[model samples]
Target chain A: MKLSIENLNSFYGSVQVLRELTLHVNTGEVLCLLGRNGAGKTTILKSIMGLVEHNGSIMLGDCEISGLGAHEIPRKGIGYVPQGRRLFAELTVKENLQIGMLIKGEDSHSLDRIFKLFPVLKERLKQESGTLSGGEQQMLAMARALCLQPGVLLLDEPTEGLMPSMIASIRDVVLKLREQGVGILLVEQRIDAVLPVANRVAFIENGYVKAEMERDELANEPDLMRHYVGI
Target chain B: MDFGPFLFLATLEGLVQAAVLCLIALGLSLVFGVMRVVNVAHGEFYMLGAVLAWWITGWFAGNPAIGFVAAIIIGPLLVGVIAYFVERLILRKVEYDPEATIVATIGILYIVQQLVLITFGPDARPVDTPFYFLIEFPWFGYSGYKLLVICAAIMLLLAVWYVITRTRLGLVMRATQYDRETAQNFGIAVNQVYAIVFATGAGLAAVAAVLIVPIQQAHYLMGRDPLLLSFIVVIIGGLGSIRGTLVAALIIGLSDGIISVFFSPTLAKMVSTLLVAMVLVFKPEGLFGSRSQL
Candidate 1:
């Protein structure tokens, strides 16, 4: 399945945050969205997931999912983690995961999969999710998105503000999702951390993709990397 | 004079009143704990419960004993079913908006109260206590029926505690209260939980009304006093805390009991209100509240 976003634009009341952005991710591929803060990266992801009102064409495979509500979007083969790990804080880790599965309308072995990848969650399954470290919460957030077993998974800043080791763990989790043959559209502020795992990268500026690159060829484009990523 | 006997009577009466207060207010607190709506018309559900009990007893007037018990149990069940559908049809649709909920539920309260008056007539109906033997106990002269109400209320509290602390449904309810979106993400059917919680709350209010009606006769205005007192208890106890609600109920109940024993019932109510006002001013978290946030 390919998650294709074309001419996508979103607004916060009168102010337009996302403007005519286009990007796509094929099955079993991780497509990273790169942009500085306030560059409309999160807006694009939120719009696609129907958390914000937007004008655009969002196609999951051949199906147009732009008009669907946030809750309905997951049922149509797209899962969203949302920003800030918008988890139920008072609930236990297991309950948080269970809520994601409940929405899927399918009974998958999500519990086994979550524990298999993040064994720490298994030990802390009964503990309140809010008490978990930010990295653990992020892992549960990602695991919750995956529990839906979507054909297309859209994540916004899955590894933001984490310790170096925790960031690497999340990056590893993204790679593992790719290995499981899932299509991923990852929005990130840290370009370098995601580019290595991402098969393709798009640099978004002013709600538009200013540049797109294949990860393997990015090494030779020193000027493009320096200008776009500011690294 | 004889302070021991008066104090003993007040203690017994206060405990019984507290038990009923806790039962009804717990439901109010539970609904507030999750939905954040005051459910202004919650009192009307209690009214409906008493009216249903009266209606059922009238239906089975052959043997007053059988009629009374059946009416008490069935009253709340009937009201619970009605409340379930009412929530789905009306409250659930507008649960997100608090202002809208207040207006709508207040509207529902008037509609329900008027309906009861029309059906049962304007006069307050007398519900006979099923048990006639005035169980005479040392230090307190009380009817066995009143003791029965207190015991049933305590048992209900225990059952509620078990359901909340020992069951999966209880966890979901608590989780839903603290954060709704998260509960939905975890695959918990939030709407189902809301319906069940709302019905249980309604049933509880219904039971509370029927239990106390024998001591304090049933009237169209029955919902008023309980509603006012329970709100005070819930406020002083802290919203959404069961332990807090129970504690607050006892405090208000005992104060009212003692005041009415020595002073007037009106004075007791005034004193209780004054106490609640002080709590809200100083320790808004209540006697046993864990946190300020809901």
Candidate 2:
């Protein structure tokens, strides 16, 4: 599966956030979006998820999903894990996962696979998600999205305030998902942690893609990364 | 009248009032709980149900039971259909905004009242009880149908509890109540859920009206008192808590019945209103309601 975007423009009320932004993610690859705060990295993901109004087309493997409602985007094979780990705080961990299954009509057997991925969730299936720790909530969010079994996953700052050990665990989960051939569009500010998992890095500034570097090129050229991302 | 028989009668009356109030306030509570939209026209839906019951019974020449049965089933269904349209057309247009929906519902209250007055006429009408058998108490006989209303209310409340606890639809509603954006992202159609919740809430109120129209005459303006009482029940019970609504309904209903029987009906209303004010001043979250995040 591939997600291709061309000339995407988004706005919040009258202020423009994303201006003619273009990017793509192929199956079995992880594309990381790196940028400063208020740089429109999250807006691009929101635009793809149909959460925000946008002008350009978002093609998810031949189908244009830009005009679809936010709820319809997930059914069209695009899963989204929004910023702040927007879990249903009052709902149980299991019920939160069940919401995704209800939409896609997937069976309970897939839950076993998810539980294997996040064993802590299995033990706390009946517990309310709001009571969980930050790392646990992040795991629940990712697991909830994965329950959709989408072709492409959009993650916005999955490890924003996690501890070091929790960050490593999240990084490992992303790498494992990559091995399973789920194309991932990850937005992150922590370059050191995301560098190991990213297949290619896209530096965005002012809602535009400033530079694109392959993994080998990023490893070889530290000055180029500093020049574009200002890291 | 002897005090013993009078006390028994008052308790029975209280139970009936509690049953009806539970049904009405449950609808209000569920709507507030899920959608956070205060339906100002909720009482009109009840009045519509009663008016519809009177109309449906008018068609049958004999056997008031047939009319009663048909009204109980058809009243709620018709109100549910009307509510579905109202939500999709009016409430949905307002984006379910708290203040906007309140104004829209108040407009709906007047519209429904005027429509009923014009079509159903301005007279208050009574529905005959389905059965005439009376329950023989030790001192006096009591209406068997009133007792049946209490039993039916218990069964219906149990059914509602089961649906909320065991059904997938309930899970979807709870998830939506917790976080609408996340629920939408997970592929739950939030708009569709809102429409369904709105319809169901109206239907529940209609059911209460159908059950009570036999005792209380159906009038175009009768919705006013029930609306006031239901708001009081919801407020004292906690705005959006179903369990709180039920408990508060019982407390208000029983006290109203006993006080009305012992003293004056006006005193009952005054005392309940005072209690509501006290609850608001002290524990705004209500006796049973937890502090809501939203």
Alpha-carbon lDDT, every model: 0.81, 0.89
DockQ of 1: 0.34
- Backbone clashes in model 2, listed as residue pairs: none
- TM-scores, chain B, all models: 0.94, 0.98
Off by over 4 Å in 1: A6-22, A54-78, A100-110, A149-151, A205-211, A217-231, B89-95, B187-192, B290-294
lDDT of 1 by residue, B1-294 (tens): 378888878877888889899988998988888777788888899888887777777878677788878887899998888888878888889854889888888988999899888777777888777766776657656778777888998899889889986666776777677766545444556678788888889999999988877666677767877888889999899888888888899999888888888888999999998989998999887766654233
True-structure RMSD, every candidate: 3.2, 1.8
Q: Please name the candidate that would achieve the greatest DockQ relative to the true structure.
A: 2
Per-residue lDDT tens digits for candidate 2, residues B115-204, read: 999998999999998888899988989999999999988898888878776789888888787778778787889999998988998999
Q: Mark the 10 consecutive residues where model 1 chain B has the least summed lDDT.
A: B285-294
Which regions of candidate 2 are displaced past 4 Å? A219-230, B1-5, B291-294
- TM agreement with the true structure for every prediction: 0.88, 0.96
